[model samples]
Target: MGDELRADQFRTEAASPRGFRQVYVREGVGGVPLLLVHGWPETKRIWWRNIAPLAAAGFEVIAPDLRGFGDSDVGPDGFHDVPSHARDLYALVRGHLGHERVVAVGGDLGGPVIQDLSLRFPGFVERMVLFNSPLPYDRERMAGLRTRPPREASDYFVPQGTDADALAAELATPEMRRRYIATFYTSRFWAHPGAFAPEEVDFMTEPFGDGAKLRASFGAYESTFSEAARSEPTAMACPNPTPTLVLFGPSDHVIYPDFDRMAAAVFPEHTGPFRLRDCGHFVQWEAAHALNSAVTAWCGDLLAGRRRQ
Candidate 1:
């Protein structure tokens, strides 16, 4: 896999006003600077498949490994909450990119982070694109986790005996792993039977092999949401005028089935919604071509207008 494509890394120090440590990524080139933030249990590597294509289409892309995930230094107290995460994002963009205004593209946990980033740092963000994220939705109404109690892990792979161990174990097993993979590809992932090349599956599974790492990643998810919900409302009081686009699989099981409604309520004025037929939560991975095309076209329109202005 290392021979297939080379990934370059850039390191920079970004601190939230609270003195919390934050690290982010900067990659790709062209068009407006676009920051791509990955969700829980995933690293900046999640953007591997999309970066080159987007860069080729003339868009500068940056996919950052949020705090407590990947190689970034973990915060002492762990700034896993939403506002802190968003603030970390704000610092990263402001301190590293040096662009007063840019676009943010996020999915899953990155979705809400970007949403808060847009609201909190409105002037710095010119536009937003959210993929299969649960933003501005009632926590109690979330579809998949509605009945389940909030997970207690601080990161993606919690230890087996720990509260989040079961989830970690499930993701590690063959059958549950297949189902988890299906959550991304939906019916199509199974169409080819051998569709998930062993190498591809290995790449996905490699990160979670270590129980400690897995637990930390799982814990990040649990910690971020609870923090976000508590602080997001106060931070998101003002309506965001930045033009935003939302794309999702209507049949997604991870996000609420009624996500469209949530998207509407989140960005009342500047939101455009697109539903991918038969797609699931991992739209970017499962439907890369479609997702890339949609984003490229939308970004093209925005960039062209910026030039015209």
Candidate 2:
């Protein structure tokens, strides 16, 4: 991860038809551009380990601070739903990067964002990759959650989704907020225990040091409960046609078990729900070398015109 990363900023409109200011880092200037989207409890910097290798392998690696995370501006009046992020990404790739197509990859919240991108900009995506995320599963499976992990596993979701004002007040300062976000990197509920080194912890915590930004990350969960984000993907007239690749961490406690079924249902022609042994929800961080290798290889296959459109 030693390449000199370059930064670029685009107006919110440029990120999506209705998205906000996004700051992205790039590591190469040629080859098929790869758009990497980050997820919750972290920033684009989460890819710090994978980007250099992916770029050096000959792809333009572009990772952006998702709306309401990192230095990117919060979304429309704090509406940081998956649809909004997807739309912004569409704009970023089309209007800002001046490319009509890209090879897309995402994890965690990014999975949903990429799903929405496939929905909104159907022909623009050339290939897709996902990990540590969810597909649009049946409502019954969501109800099945009650039969799964102790509900306490999702206790954090309630406050972040509903009582955000109170949570923000509780984490009043940047340092205090960083400590709260740090829980994810160290908690069995999110990351594998002791997954981050002290320095890595600091790097992950630095962006949340902005109290306003920390508060903003909560809205994505909130959007799920809000009327804006509740529609089922089954309602789509068709499934996304883009060839897809999926990777997962076997030990994840956050994403419910049986996600592979949903992944298969959504992406019928997908590659793997390949498990990352001894890892958790943050597979990208925990399994960088394998992740980078798989993604680089997948991108290579895409560039070689081997994958379906």
Candidate lDDT scores, in order, read: 0.60, 0.73
lDDT of 2 by residue, 206-268 (tens): 889887888878878777667754333312222556788888776677776766555655676
List the RMSD of every prediction in angstroms.
Answer: 6.2, 4.4
Model 1: residue 28 alpha-carbon error in angstroms: 3.8
- Report clash pairs, candidate 2: 12-20, 15-88, 15-92, 16-88
> Best-fitting candidate, measured by TM-score?
2
Off by over 4 Å in 1: 1-25, 138-197, 210-212, 224-240, 305-309
Model 2 ranges off by over 4 Å: 1-19, 139-150, 228-239, 304-309
Tens digit of lDDT per residue, candidate 1, span 1-309? 564323343433344543544554555544567888887546676677777687677677777667666555454554355666687777766775566777888887787778778878757777888777656544433444333212331122233224555676666655554445333332433212343455555555454444445444554445533543233343543245667787876655446556665665557565567877766666666567877787788788766765565
